[model samples]
Target: MLIHRIFQVVTVIDCVVGMMASGFIVSVGSTDWMRRRKLPACDRILICLCSSRLLLQGTILHATLFPELTQWNVVRGHSVLLVLASTACLWFAACLSVFYCLKIATFTQPCFLLMKLRISAMVPQLLLGSALISLVSSLPFLWVDYSSHLCNSTRSHLKNISFESPTGNNISYFKGFVMYVTWAVVPLLFFIASSTLLIASLWKHIKQMRQNATGFKDSKTEAHITAIKSLISFLMLYICSFIAEILLGIPSCQAMSRWKHNICSLLIAVCPSVHSILLVLLNVRLKLAVKSILLYMKCHRKQDSAEALWQERKSMSSS
Candidate 1:
């Protein structure tokens, strides 16, 4: 029980960090949108990604803090929304990876060139389609018996989660399996493909750059290297979290001991927080924002310390 509580605290902390990081992404995109009255293609996709992830984190926070509320009728609706949000997060992430691949990868293939040329125009449609697909995938759950399947415990990590039909109904389990494929596996495949292409393109570009007479890495080479590094890290993080989520949502896994279940849940919760922070560090503008914020905070703390020192000196002199 002590371990369970500790795990819950850790999960709560993860959700809070995820929420803050996601909120930062949303604020950055929203500020740019409001200021310019227009959003760039990447920011548009990012906004959608953050929004869905924010929803995912918020729902997790609610469940983590209020595990006992899982039995409530209203929790069913929230669970369904959580599934939709989680699905949308996966889709938007796949779209973002594809977008990055198109923007940065140099491929002479006609299809690749055509996609690169048109990806900006396709961003809006892709965003809409992602949400629509997630909605359609999640609609079947509205009719399923929520209590029998979704409200499995006092633990909220998997509350209202997808890909698990109620136990003993082979047909429902089949439905759950299909939804899981559509919701997660498909996006994972898409992401893997995009990352592979992007990495290959970067490697080829670096090899060519090395052959240049300058014999020094240029800015473009550095940029490509940075992107490749980011993509690889993101890819690994995402794949691990994806596997953890699959384990968490499995019906058989639910019968496992509490500590094992909590461990899996913690693994699933890490992706949003870590990925959002990675995005901040990877984007030039967002990195600047973070640096400025940190600098200001440091200055403010120094000012407070100086003021306290002066007050102490004055009090000593007075004595």
Candidate 2:
């Protein structure tokens, strides 16, 4: 148990660092790059997603540090809303990937169809999808209380976690299974399948375009590939998380086991960090923004040193 607590502490620290990095990336990357590009506003959407993810990470981190909140107690109603918001962000990101893939692949038929749909129409759909999933996933929590030791909606508690019926008035098992299917299994499948197909389609298109010596603009193709790689990285992170979740759910698996906990804890942090890397490494506008931020930092440091020197001279004169 002491070892488990230590692991949780480490995981929390990592999550905090990742969240901070993501915040910086979003502030610097979104306004500087996404807004400038006049692209379909995907990067800003991702920034919002990452921010929600960061909030989820913080909730988990607080739970790990305090430990007394238990599974059912840790995530409040608003936390559930944030989690649902995160899911919405992720779905929007998947849509962003699909839009990007179509944009790059020059699938004129589908592109025309997609263009006919307004961004406003799409936002409500994604939000509704997220809301339904959250509602279903959280149904089990309504039966349990803050004191229950069982893994309610959030999968944190193990020993004191209530699995059996509390008052025999509730269907805990049924609800738990629903939560898993709605939140984990189904969403995981969609994330994996959609991202995989998008990548494959982009790959084929890029190869065909290359072979045909098609008049497809080279710079545009390269930009599409960059976005593709970033999306692939995001999807792969989700896949890792899905696998970790499955491993954690196995009956034979020890809930407090180091490996299960470690992987699960790490995913909480790693997912957002991957987004930060993509923004800085893949997007040219983000890279420039980072460069500008660095330059500003250097200049600020130099000014601080100059101020210190002036203060020292003034002190010497007073002496």
Which lDDT values do the candidates have, in the order given? 0.80, 0.59
> Candidate 2: which pairs clash?
149-160, 149-161, 150-161, 150-162
lDDT of 1 by residue, 1-319 (tens): 8989999999999989988988998998899899999999989988999899888888877777876664444555665777788899889999999999999999999999999999999999999999999998877656544433443445443534633334322335336645765668888899999999999999898787767749554887778877787788889888888777666666553534576678877876788788888888888999998898999999999999999999999999999
* Model 1: how far residue 301 lies from native, Å: 4.6
- Worst 10-residue stretch by lDDT in candidate 1? 162-171
Tens digit of per-residue lDDT, candidate 2, span 85-198: 445445545555554544454445665457535553564465456546655555555443333323433445543444333344344433443455466555556556656666
- Give me the runs in candidate 1 sitting further than 4 Å from their true place: 146-174, 253-256, 300-319
- On the 0 to 100 scale, the lDDT of residue 90 in model 1 is 89
Which candidate number maximizes lDDT?
1
Query: Model 1, residue 116: displacement in angstroms?
Result: 0.6
